[model samples]
Target: MDIRWITAFLDFEPAAHERATAFWSAVTGYAVSEPRGEHAEFATLIPPNGDAYLRVQRQEEGPSRIHLDLHVDDVRRHADRAISLGATELVACDYVTLRSPGGLEFCFVTHPGESAPPMTQWDGGLASAASQLCIDVPASRWDAERDFWGGVLGVPIEYAGGSYAQTPPSADRPMHLVLQRLDDDPPTVGAHLDFETNARDDEAARHQELGATVLDTGPEWTVLRDPAGLPYCICGPDCR
Candidate 1:
């Protein structure tokens, strides 16, 4: 399937919607576009350049989590193809909503001309982009889920070791996919955003000042909980 563009939706419960939106806007240095969608539950984070690909949604229930919205020339066609592969369709039509065999949620929508935006530059020569979507699948479901996404993405999923398999990043693709196998099988699958930053220490500090709680830090990445209670990571000083 030819996925022309990809958008990451950061969904939060009603109580934390506003705060989460603000935090993400500052984190990516993107302006929060005016709210749209029925009941005013949707908005896009408009960047300084390029069509917006990050969005925010106010949820009535469910924990704050990230979901991918894939843009393509033929929504229904590609969507059906995904369903034919291991994805189970949750909603049907020109725009489709479905869950992967491993249970991660995603959508197919009509494509427009959108190019990936340049990384936002912060003070002190720090640069960052919320560029990768790390899909956390339980160890038992990794094989099926990896195969499904790899087919849908029309790319090879190469194991990068340490329980990680990734589709090589392409300039034409807006979001890169990384499949991670969890040691403990949780009740459900989840995804998180990873910011590739040149100055990891400084970037972590900036995010903390914006109300993110640092949960854990390691040599490779530092995990933090956003204001809305969703965990994300400041992953590198150029390390993937």
Candidate 2:
């Protein structure tokens, strides 16, 4: 099973342009792209092959559109690193959750025992996994959702933690999964992306086996919803 990239969005309300830029840059160690306009919009400048980005947009209230999550090799180590870097611990459960100086929330969950490649490419270990955005669900319901995500889609829940549910990818590929309850909001539907098996016949078989109900299908993409009314879709390899 190949795991691909997962993208997330953040509503940076009660935040200023300069502060947001600096905060995200410091957190991800990536440069900030110039704003397209003056209303405080920015995109993270990532390496050409990197899988994540931080798109900061002004919000009237706060974070209505998305919550962020991440997969870490070791949650405790990175969470400590984040804290040392001036990130504050927000929620500490099975995994460690932290907020940037600008108040953006994210968490780090250790991917399980399976041996993944190291962060280097064109050589020895696989690329080290670091992301700027993740999907957050409720911590309490993570197990249920993990089962549903696995059962509905015929995919295994590869790695799990207090607030995270990960689906590992095949060797030499990327990874993606959802984070549960990084906040205190009530349970509601969310839209996300999932990768199915490569072959059309195999993907279709997995879709039916996983209980995925199709909402839209295009030559390049197929949109569907999970059992809990969440908006999730399957895409061809190029959709990344």
Candidate 3:
């Protein structure tokens, strides 16, 4: 099962879908496709050139969160491989949804010839380029989660710090998968999108202008909430 494509999906509530779509389009410099699906809940964020790597979906239930879509040559084979590596199957339909060892949910879908979008360049010395899907793992599940993703994706896990591990991007696959070990008493597991920027403050300000709020800030990254209340991050220059 070859991992042919990776997509970062922004799941939003129905009431907030429009706002979320508009905000993300402005931030990433992409155009949103017409809504598809039975309830018109699914849409793609299309880049001016190249294939789309981002999508938006209106959730029928639960709060907004980020999830990944792995497009593979064989969905069933990929799902089986993931399950054998400790992922629990959640659904098996047109696509297969599985929860990783660290608790982050992702899906295996048929390849649609999608490819990573090229990084956009912004003016004002605000270089907000490249996007990353970060997997938040509990400290206890960190090692297993890292190993699971590395094996499933056929990528090497590169340790950045005591708690940070990431799979470097290759020419064929441009998206990155980062595993971050949390320090919470009972660590929480989830996924979030991260934007690499040369000017964090300026880029964050731009996002604020587009209706996103800064939830928190650290030495290297700033946490933000979209109009739909989904949390994402803006990491500093070192992000890759």
Q: Could you tally the backbone clashes for each prediction?
A: 0, 13, 0
For model 3, the stretches where C-alpha displacement exceeds 4 angstroms are 112-115, 185-188
Name the 10 consecutive residues with the lowest summed lDDT in model 2. Answer: 124-133
lDDT of each: 0.87, 0.47, 0.83
Error of 3 at 235 (Å): 2.0
Q: What's the TM for model 2?
A: 0.39
Per-model TM-score on C-alpha atoms:
0.96, 0.39, 0.91
Clashes of 3: 0
Clash pairs for candidate 1:
none
What tens digits encode model 2's per-residue C-alpha lDDT throughout 106-188?
55654432332232222222122232123445555555545544542236866555445565544533444444444565454
lDDT of 1: 0.87
Of models 1 and 2, which has the larger lDDT?
1
User: In model 2, what lDDT does residue 120 have?
Assistant: 24
Runs off by more than 4 Å, candidate 1: none
Give the candidate number with the greatest lDDT.
1
